[model samples]
Target: MRLSATSLEQVPPGIARYSYHRAAQDIGIVHFGLGAFHRAHQAWYTDLCMDSGERGWAISGVSLRSPTVAEQLNPQDGLYTLTERSGGESTTRVIGAVREVLVATEERETIIARLGSPGVSVVSFTVTEKGYARRTGGSLDLAAAEASFYPLLTDGLRLRRERDLPGLTLLSCDNLPANGRELERLFGEWLTERAPDLAAWVAAECAFPSTMVDRIVPATTPSDIDALENLLGVRDEGAIFTERFSQWVIEDRFAGPRPRWERHGAQLVRDVAPYETAKLRMLNGAHSALAYCGLELGHEFVHQAIGDPMLRGLIERLMRQEAATSLAPAAGQDLEAYADALLARFADPALNHRLIQIAMDGSQKVPQRWLETLAYHQRYGEPCPALIEAIVAWLRHVRGDRRPVDDPMAAQLAALWATEGSSGIAAALFGPQGLFSHVWRADEASLARLTRRLG
Candidate 1:
């Protein structure tokens, strides 16, 4: 028999339950991506609000791309387990903050209509770096084909034009720098082109709050399910296993009523710039460097890569040298302490953050984490030996052994590299155009250094 929400008593001990059949009052938030990270971080925060007995802070999960996740989750009655694994011990907590799941692709009109609902005070997204459709220069990428056709074309710009809802806050929990401003510019461009009237309306009303979200949620493995059943004594179809650490920092920008997330561990600040830069540049940038270099070195997972002293040294050097330069305002942040913490997180023997998974979508990632700093160093005449090495490693990853990296931008990088032979790889790296842009095109000496390192 199919499990129902009302069958909580049937659920084994240690597994929490939520009754989907219970009446749900329309709440204040709508989350765009129903990924594992969202389940572990944002949903957990909302659950804390619910536990506090605060009303109107519930969330309606929206999946914009596929129906598979909705199909899997809805049958479980929007119930999911947040499994935390550290060392040899594990804990499980079922999240109930998600009141419902909406498959936006299957119900596009319905999804759009929900945005217009009176109860939805805020619209949030964890759609990763690519979801915003941003350009390399840290602006909204309105030139995308979908920007002309899709309802939100470029991060809800078109939708705001059609509805003109002023009292709405658009929060982005992605890993981009100045994520909120980037969303604004994308929507701004669409408004200037499509509907000037609504564009003006959006300018007057609406909030795009920048955020920094951190957590390590690896793709669920079969062993994880086995462990969950053994520990929780229950079958959980929607369980997400992750590392013990998680953090969220948000700029205080909300319209209408919102949840008191600060009651939980979340930090609410006037400006999220310093926090955002610190996480983006140091943590995420090092992650990218390790992913490319580690994968090329035949490492399968993050922890496995960390096991290699050479790769570990490379990661340390990259963080200490190249990545450190990008975080100007956050310079006071304990670099060594942060690096030590990141190393421990990355080296968690339990979490299997696959190199191939990290290797995917390098095109979307490299621009922010690697190339941006390279450009910064070039413009200001800063030393960047480790950054240059990371770039060389990334180039090797793209070219080496056809290891089947899974990034969406892999094809684009391949095409760019195909213009020249292996020797031309350095030329492309130093090219005047493409994602690297003119600012990052290394001089002959730098190119020679990169070429020598790759060879």
Candidate 2:
């Protein structure tokens, strides 16, 4: 018989399993954007809590954009497998931390109602960088503001206001640096424009806890599902595949009740800025560098790029140069060791995090992860040749001659590329008040170097 969520009683041998009925009874957290990464990381932590018989950490997965995820997960009765691959061995665990899957598209009111519920202590988001509708300077993208504001205002925030809901913690799990502050700014901006009174109420009542989350969970494929069935003797159509390493560092700014996530290996700190800077500059910056530069060198996936001796060397050098200088001591980090571990993680052949996946939203990502470090080096009178080269690669990739792939930033970057001249592409990237105003003032020689590299 096919294993259904209802059929689950005890935890399965290879996979952590639970019955649908049992999951339904547990509640405390509501997570937005129920993607693979969230499942592999946050939900995994919650699963640890559930196994320990802890209360107030069970999650309700919510999807804002697509009905497809809800459809796929609900049929499995919200039961999914999390496969962790390291060196040569793989471990499969069925995560039943998610009690329910709700499609906000079909039932927007229902989602808002759930968010407004007194029982829901935390509202966490993993909606990616673009989901915030933010621009480069860590400000709300007023031009693209409606994409997020409309849904949040009408469906989520409005309901919260109407119901006079109590304060709750808002945790953002996107890759953006200072994610908490960014959300605060966005929410503040949206509210000031639409509902000033409620905005003040939110400012006083809610907590936007900044967090640093890291893991590589690629989109699930049929082969992954097949592997789950063959290895664990169970059919899990909604299985998620990821690397073995995971980390979550949270700033303890919660106004309401929160999971003792620390119990499940999550670190609760007084401030997460140092950790955020370390991860963003060292890990995310290097990833962006590899994504553009390695893709330009004719690679399809991150593991493939790491396998190449020359590109691998380039990645290591860039990380050592850029990240080492950018990370602050307060981040409580070891730059060298972190870089070494990053290289090994990227080289994990079993995890297929594609180049295209990392290459997405370069316009939104580069400012925080790469450009900020470059600007820091510039201010200190240091050479950022490798970092500059990565920017050039990004500019070339955006020009559509090198990668030939479609990215969300393609059109905007193409427009920027058209303005490139003997003056330089660096000028174009930095001169734009929209993206890099806070960091760079557009140096002539740097622009010249960028132009020369592109030529």
Candidate 3:
């Protein structure tokens, strides 16, 4: 048996599952980057809302790059299982909020048409940071912009404007700091050059609310699929396994209607920067450090690395003493408690959060996760020993000294590393055009500490 609408009755017993039987439900949300995280987090939340008898918000997921996700879920009638594991306990739920999956390569016109629909009150995206085509200086890369998601999104918005439909909320669910404002600037710049009238309309009408989404979603392997099948007595190609923990914090500003995500545990706040900053620097920063350092240390999974007392100790100091110093005290937040909880989450053995998986797109991830905090320390004349170690490991990883690199800037970085050799790699890494351009390279004391620690 396969897990589809027809086979819902056979989805094992005792699992908390539901079916989307609302015939009048329309697509009220369009999402870009239909990856595992979006499926596990946003779509799951919308599913919960529907389970509570909330109508609308059925998602039409779009893939900007390939058709792999569409290939996986469309056959099963947009149905897939989410297995949330915590410690030794696990629960499976079949998600039905995803009404359809469309690929840009196959249905660009349909995507544009749907975006212009009055029914779609939200245009949300989980397109990774690299998809934004943002430079280190927070400026859009004009050449790369044309080939990125921004252009596609602008086209959709243009269609909406021409159709005279109500402007939708442009929600950015990526990990970049001030992600909503970044999208606002990105779309604003593109529109100003192409269509000035649309730019003014977007500025006056559309809302780009910043969001903080936290979940540990690992890449699904064949073993995971087999295990899920054994549990449900059905094969589900679209199944995803994730940690039981999840969070969604949104800046409470929307142009039009949105799913009452607050009804289902999402935080809607006036300012998301404080929460965003704390989570990015502490949680995301530690994850990047673990990825680079753990990969260098030959640890495959996050649990394997975090389980080690020594590595865990290093991470603790990084979070509490180093990264936390740069963040403003968020109201009602226990920074130390959050740090401890992060370690527990990282040490969750059930979800195999691979180091290499987190390590991919290092060029895109480092600036926000590691360099931002390091820059703060340098500005204050303080030392950041743990962050330095992570940077050294990243330099090694990008240079292919330890493992295969999977970054978009891999070719450029490899060429620089090869030209510079061991003696010059450090300088090249912190150079003007490198990923760590904002990091201090002239501070002799910090450089010495980095050298001593790296040695």
Candidate 4:
């Protein structure tokens, strides 16, 4: 039997089924990019709130890319299992906070209508870094810009404005430095070009709160689905597996009322900048290093990379030395402790976090993860050979031929590789015309360092 609302009663006792879920509750949130992280993190927190007697904040999840996720869960009545796994132990829970799923390509109008609804006071999203369509110098990529998150967001907010509905809180749960502010700026630029009036309204009424969300959700494999079936004695097509650890830190500012996610262990802080910078530079930066370097050395998974002595050493140096230069920790914040915890999480054997998965879209990731820190290092006269090495590894990964690079700029980069010499290619890549800041292009010493490493 397939797991569904009707089959909830028959679910095995070992599975942690939600008892407080109600289909009749009004949906108060519309989340975009409904992937595993959203399911395991945000939806899990909302489910806990429902269990604790908060009933008005159900989620309507919208998958932007394709209908694959909706196809998997909609038949199950928006029900799915989330298995939290650690070494030799796991716990399963049925998440019901997501009351509906909509495929944006197929249901764009419906999504806009939902976003315009007075009942939905929050429009949260977890679109990855690439979804922002950013250029290298931390500006909006308006040249190749097509239909993306900001465009859709503009249409929805315009609808809300037309309906005279109050502005909603726009929460960004992606892993970008100052994600909320970055999103607000990107959306503002786009809106100003398209509709100046709506842009002003958004500037005044909408609140784009920065957020830091931490969770290790590996891509669910076929074997994982089989394991879920064995554990639950029912088919759960939409099942997801993740590590036991999770954290969410959000800026307290919002345009309107939102779920008291703090009540369920999320931190509501005055400024998420410190937390956001730490995670992006230390955790995400090291993850990219692992991805590019590990792939070059034949390590496929995160644990394998961390377990390898050489890769592990580079990652440690990255967090403790190079990446730390730009970090300003609050009192009682232990950098070493945070690094230790990240190492432990990355080394979890039960989690099959793929290096290639992290490696995807390097063009989008490198700016925030590595280049921004590189800029800080240059400004402060900090040594960053480890970061340079990681950049070399990324360059080699893009240049060499084990698998096709999955970046949006892959074809353009490949064309450059085919045409240009090493110095020329490096110059183009770090040049003003390319995806990097002009300062990098002008810094001959930095260019020489990277060229030496690449050679």
Residues 69-103, model 3: lDDT tens digits? 99899888888999999889888998889888999
lDDT per model vs. reference = 0.73, 0.76, 0.85, 0.85
True lDDT of residue 170, candidate 1: 81
The predicted structure with the larger lDDT, 1 or 4, is: 4
Q: Can you rank all candidates by lDDT, best first?
A: 4, 3, 2, 1
- On TM-score, the stronger of 2 and 4 is 4
The digit string of per-residue lDDT tens for model 1 on 1-455 reads 22336544565764654433234545567788888888989888888777767776667788877776687578867777887888777777777777778877576666666677667778888877777665655555556625322254233444544565545788888887888887777777766765676666677677788888899888887777776666555566677989889888888887657788888889888788878877777788888777877877888889998889988887887777777666655535576687789989999888889877777677677777777677777777776776777788778777635676566566766776677656667767566653566436776677778778866
Name the candidate, 2 or 3, with the larger TM-score value.
3
Off by over 4 Å in 3: 431-435, 439-442, 451-455
Q: Candidate 3 has which clashing residue pairs, if any? A: none
Model 1: per-residue Cα lDDT at residue 351: 82
Per-prediction TM-score: 0.90, 0.92, 0.96, 0.96
How far does residue 196 in candidate 4 sit from its true spot (Å)?
A: 2.0
Lowest-scoring 10 consecutive residues by lDDT in candidate 3? 433-442
**What's the CA error at residue 233 for candidate 1, in Å?**
4.5
**Backbone Cα, N, C clashes tallied per candidate:** 2, 2, 0, 0
Query: Which lDDT value does model 2 have at 446?
Result: 72
